[model samples]
Every structure is written in structure tokens, then in C-alpha cells.
Target: MHQWRTWHRPLVLFAAAMAVMTVVSGVGLLVDDRVLTGAAIWSKPFKFAVSFVVYALALAWMLTLVTRGRRTGWWAGTVVALSSFAEMAIITAQVVRGKRSHFNHATPFDESLFNAMAVTVVVLWAGTLLIAILLLRARIADRASAWAIRSGVSLALVGAGFGFLMTQPTKEQRAAGNLDTADVIGAHAVGVPDGGPSMPLTGWSTTGGDLRIPHFVGMHALQLLPLFLLAVTALAPRFVRLRDPRVRLRLVQVASGAYAAVTALVTWQALRGRPLIHPDGATLTAAALTLAATAAGTYGALRTGSGAHTSPSAEKELVS
Candidate 1:
């Protein structure tokens, strides 16, 4: 309801496309490898098609920003979309070429290529996050609505950012020449010869033991937590004078705390030899924080709203 007229259509389309693609990808996963005679050829088309849809959706979303004076954000998002398209195009091309290891092939899918793709996607997504933050900071939108929008933007970008990183071969794996040939590996494969994961589990590698897994997981929380905060803030009583100031302070507190907590939890677990995909104490802690923040924000907003209901007397006094 808050400025849904701005970017609602594009965002909805993007969400729908993403949902459909997710189902498609999931179904593809269920299809046994041996059954598909042309697995790569048939399998890859879905992804490629999904990739184009995503690209178009992203572009459309950016277009919605022109009214908001977000030229920079638009361009940044465009670049990320382009990079993603490039990645998918390359993978589809490899599949078309009958490359067995479409993901991790040392030949065409080399480290440099991966590095470029990773950096571009990461930077672009991060850029989107920054733009969302800036949008609020610039006061281009109402405080309550801006907060919600920014939080959603941050979460989606963070999720996508780590997703990009997880697709690439790790530095250590590349250095040791023990990289996996396929982009997605099953759970039964042998660990890296020298001491890597036998198989990639939910995009986490046992071999290099990088922070990729936790990072990806942490980024996803950005969506739920921030939106919850925004919602609560929106429903709160309008402070006659200091409402904006108070909301801004709270938003900063929540965002900073959540970011730090997630980062710490992820880092600690990864360093302590825990894999990212597996549920553990640290991940649970992060989840708790996210839930707690949402609850607190909701409760605070209700309390404020309740107080507003009783403020007519004060308003009469001021009027007199």
C-alpha cells in the first residue's frame, strides 16, 4: 500500500518469475541424471530461460526507479543483471557444446572468468544495497515506507550476492588445481584430493572451507528482518516532532546489530570447522535475532499505535 504504485508491478513480476524458476530448478534436481539422455542440453535450457526472465525483470524494476531519481541505482542494478545474464549464457553455451563439467571446467570456465563474474555480481548487488540505503538517507520517500523498501532491497541483494559467490570455484581450490568441474556437485563426490569437501553441499565446500556458505545464509536474513522492522515502524504512532529521529535511530540500531551478529555467528561457525549447510548453533542464533527483532518491532509499533488512540486529549489542549 505504501507507494506500491512506484515499483509494484516489476517487483511482483520478478517475484513470480523467481518462484516459477525455483520450482523448475527444483524439479530438474529430481530428474535422475542417468535418465536424461541429453541432460545438459535439456536441463540447461530451463536455467537459461529463467536467466533471461530475471534479466528482463531486473531491468523493469530499475525502470520503476526513474520516478524516484535513482539513476545510479538503476545503472548499478542493470550491470548486475547483465553480469548474471553473462554467467548464465556462458553456462548454457558450455552445455550446448556438450561440456560435461559445465560449472567447474578448467578450460573455458577458468578462474579469471569466474573471478570477473563473481566480482561484478557481488559489487553490483552490494551496490543495490547501498542505493537502497541511500534512498532512505536522501529522504526521497516517506520514512516508514523507505525503511521497509530499503530493508527488502538489502535482503534480496544480499541473498543474490552470496548466491553468485557460491557458484564460483574457491581461491584455494583453484590454486591447488583441485577445483570441481561442475557448477553444482552432488553430495556423494569425493572431497578435494588434498583436503577439500568431497562434494558441495548446498553450495558449501568442504575442501577450501571458505566462508561462502555462511555468508550466503546470513545474507538471506536481510529480507525478513528489515521488512519486519519497517512494518513495525510504519504502524507506530506518528511522533509530532521527533518521530523521524526516533525511527532512524532504531533502524540504525537494528540494522547494525543484525549485520554484526550475523557476521560474527557465520564467521565463528565457519572458523570452528562447521559446514554452512548444516544447521548449527550459530545459524540458529542468527535466526533467533532476526525473529526477535521482528517481534520487538511489531510490539513497539502496537504500543505506539495504542498510545496514539489516547492522545486526543493532548491534541485538544494543544489546539486550545
Candidate 2:
């Protein structure tokens, strides 16, 4: 119980709440088989609920890196938790009503709910941005952890920025004279309408591009980078001797950069109405270059041992 309480800081407790929501959403899927936008009515809620679990946990873990302004962490966590919960509640309500949560303002009531959801999302975004700024400005004991946290938050912001593009009217929508009105906000799929052919379960476009792909990939950078470092720390000592912490840190940096590059490529592909499965030569070349750069960075770090050093306090933090 003490361990649970100790770990269940504001953000962590919010994550626990999200976990409960995830289970409830899963139950909703079994009980409510209604379909919306070519998917199960409960699908959006389930995805968002599970996503909040990740988001809350990531924020909770990252908040520990803040050496100053602990109260700021609490305030930020509360803002994020409340805003996210409100967004989910709105989405679930719409789903229960058998209506689309996003891009739907057919009625005044629907419009009000949609607007509320949008505002909550904006508040959540602002809170996350503030947390990222705090992490970036914070002085940590561990250089590797700091690098991961900063890079992850920076990439998350980039991912969130893509939401604006999703909100913009697509070329087809614009060509069809369907501007951003009260009835329709924006579309998600490119080159084809959203309810068209899609991959099962995920609903990503199988025939066309999906802007959400990049956004989804980029948003998880917070988990990916830090987890990568943690995995390296766990595995390196056992597999290899003379493993320098700096090299591991450098590798994490390279991986983060490569991850961001791939995200950008996918976003570009989606914007161009090109499907991810059908990448052009330019896209392939870009991907190869990113991998090559990552390899080169790793090799340089290993050979030169020129990565930033971690402080003693930071090393202890990493261990804990």
C-alpha cells in the first residue's frame, strides 16, 4: 500500500483512473455492438481510454525529473487529468448517442459538445506543452534520462501540432466546396473518405494515407525514448562489458532523432496523399538515410566516448 501510494502521484493516480476507464470501455464493446463511422461505437472510447493510461503514466514518470517547482508538477498533472477526462467523457457520450464525436456539429447540442471537447483538448495540449517546457528547463542528475525526456516531450509537441492539420479541410473536401462549417470540421483519411477501406482493428487506411499514423507514432515518443534507455541499462551490463553510459545515452539520442525523422516522413506521405504501404523511392531513400545516420551516431559515440556525462545525483535517480 505504501509503495502504491508513493508511486501514485497525481499523474499516476490519473493513469489509474484511465485504466479503470479502459476496462469500462472494453466492457462497453461487448455490450454495445453498434457501429459508427465503419467501426464499433466503443472503439474510440477504448482507444482514448487506453491512450490516457499511457499518457498519464508517462507524465507521472517524467514529472519526477523536475528538480524544482514540485507544486507546478501537481498543477500541471491536475490540468492534464481533468482536461483529458472531460474529452473522454464527451467522446463516450457521443458514442453512446450513436453519433460521431469529432467533426460533427449537425445540431446545437452536438456543436456544444464538440466545442467543449475541442476546448478540453486545447487545455490538455497546453498543459502537456507546459510540462515539456518544464522538463526541458529542468536540471537532472542523469544526462541520458534528461535527453530522453526532453526529446520525447519535443516530439510529442510535434505530434500534437499535426492535430491542426487534421482539423484543416482536405484537398478533396476543399475541392468539393466543403469548407470548415458547423456541419463538418475535417477529415482523417487522405486520398479517400474516412469510412472507406481500412485495416481492421486499427482502422488505418489500407488503400489511402492516414495522417493519424504519424500523429500516433509521434505522440508515444515519451514512452519509447525513456523505455529504450531503460531497456539498454538493463541489458547492456549482462551482454557486454566496458559499456559506457555515455554511449547508451548517445544511442538513445540517435534513436530519438531517427524516430522523429520517420514520423516526419509518414506525415509528409499522408499530406501528399500517398499511402504508407506504398512508399515512393524518395520516401524509401529518406528512411534509409535516417537509419544510416542513427548507425553512424551510435558508432561515433561508441568509438569516441564523447557523449555528455551524467551527474552522480542523476545516476542515482536513474537507478531508483
Number of the top-ranking candidate, with lDDT as the measure: 2
Point to the candidate with the largest TM-score: 2
**Which RMSD does model 1 reach against the true structure?**
7.6
Residue 255 in candidate 1 has what lDDT?
A: 62
Steric clash pairs (candidate 2): 141-314, 142-314
Q: What is the C-alpha RMSD of each candidate to the true structure, in Å?
A: 7.6, 3.5
- Which segments of model 1 are wrong by more than 4 Å? 1-20, 32-68, 92-105, 109-116, 119-123, 126-130, 140-144, 151-212, 229-256, 276-320
**What tens-digit string does per-residue lDDT give for candidate 2 at 1-320?**
23344442767777888798889989988998898777888888888888889978888777766767767866887798889889888998898788898878688898889889889988888989988888877887667778888999889878877876777777777777745354766778888888877777677887788888888888889788888888877887674421555667777778888888888989988887777778889888988888888889877766644354556665565534
What is the alpha-carbon lDDT for the whole of candidate 2?
A: 0.79
lDDT of 2 at 21: 82
lDDT of 1 by residue, 1-320 (tens): 35545653533454455557556655655662432222323354464455446434543443454445466655655564555556554554544455532234346555455456556566656656655654555542344444544554555555454454345444445665645564432111122322244233243445434454445445444445445555555654665422333444355455645664565566555555455556477568777877798568645643443444335554343323
Lowest summed lDDT window (length 10), candidate 2: 1-10
Candidate 1, pairs of clashing residues:
103-183, 104-181, 190-198, 191-197, 191-198, 196-207, 197-206, 197-207
